[model samples]
Target: SLQRALWVRNVTGCKNIHLSSKLLLEDFPTDFLRAVTCQVCDHLLADPVQSPCRHLFCRTCILKYIRALGQRCPLCTFPCAPSDLVTPAKAFLGVLQSLLLRCPREDCREAVRLESFGSHCRGHQEADEEGDGGQGQTFNSYLPVNKGG
Candidate 1:
């Protein structure tokens, strides 16, 4: 029930799918990674947010950095506080959402767009629950064929 497990992990609104994993994003070129990558965690930005000084980091990462590591932006040393977080540009979100990413589970190989990954995982999760782990696969090879009819 790997699919089920993956679905459970993603119950939150956050992109817990680990889109930064190389298995999920390995197909992307290095240049593309630069645009979406969070320097603090070396992961594709999740809930990507910015500091008042405009450096980007994953929302969780920046909060952790400020709480435990330091009070300044890790990249630019600008004074940073939890309230300083801001939404990144809509144009940047567009690029991030468009990237084709793979499933985070070790078992799944479905490559999906960032925007669609949740539904993709949900389909397999539902199938696994339906006593038809094979259901998500639309080929329906198990059905009897009308041979020579």
Candidate 2:
């Protein structure tokens, strides 16, 4: 009787359907468990990040996906700047690090260290321009003076 009641509730999509106290505790449908799972890609969240529009996805999972598409929010179409995108913090990373793997980018051989993981994944490199210019000289020094008009 309890099992049949749960089956009916699930099929009808009724949220407020009554269940006996014992049945409520015991015979909750497995479908409810599956329903709350992330719809983007069906996996348990590792360091979930909620977008401004209230969509949640794993930090590494969603960032990598967005980066491929030029850093746009997958669900809400919100524009995410390259600098605004970031990795999870230390506490969150601690929980998810083992479960969440690094981006599979071939050139990114790094394994996602906690502190510098974000910069690493983004492949942020400082431009090497310190040596570009020869010893500094004023612009006037490079120009020839014309005394005769």
Candidate 3:
């Protein structure tokens, strides 16, 4: 069943892969597609991570999603327990990492390193939120901070 579904998905690129056809070669249902698709980017699953509810998203994408929305599964709104979110299998991770790209942040200017990509993204987001342009500041210039004694 999984192989057939995957074959169907691959043949149609998930755009028109249907579930109800007697031939089973038509487009998949929207709900099924949504169930399998990544909510963060609305694309086909990369390193698909199955939530407790069985909804899947790209591993990295969903982690980023969780970071933005807190620890909740987007599909069923179930609490995504910290321990439940596991890194995808090494094989899947390799495939997904090869296909994924880094965010086009000029300051980041770094390739998406596989093992540390998630950390890099989180750091980048935090840095962006903190409004610190360390790249713009000169290393030799020392700014005094007022620490109240």
Candidate 3 matches the true fold with a TM-score of: 0.37
lDDT of model 2, residue 136: 27
Off by over 4 Å in 1: 1-17, 21-29, 104-108, 132-149
Stretches of candidate 2 exceeding 4 Å from the true structure: 1-36, 82-149
Clashing pairs in 3: 16-27, 17-27, 17-28, 18-26, 18-27, 18-28
> Stretches of candidate 3 above 4 Å error?
1-26, 86-149
lDDT of 3: 0.48
Q: Tell me the lDDT of candidate 2.
A: 0.40
Over 37-131, each residue of candidate 3 has an lDDT whose tens digit, in order, gives: 45544554545676776566656655656666688896689988545766456765464344333434555556553334445555665565577
Model 1: number of backbone collisions: 0
| lDDT of candidate 1 over 1-149, digit per residue (tens) | 67743442333222333354464555666776776877566566767888888888777667766776568997888899888788899998898777777565457777787767656766666766687565454323111111211
Ranking according to TM-score, highest score first: 1, 3, 2
lDDT agreement with native, every candidate: 0.63, 0.40, 0.48
Predicted structure 3: clash tally = 6
TM-score of 2: 0.32
* Least well predicted 10-residue stretch by lDDT in candidate 2: 140-149
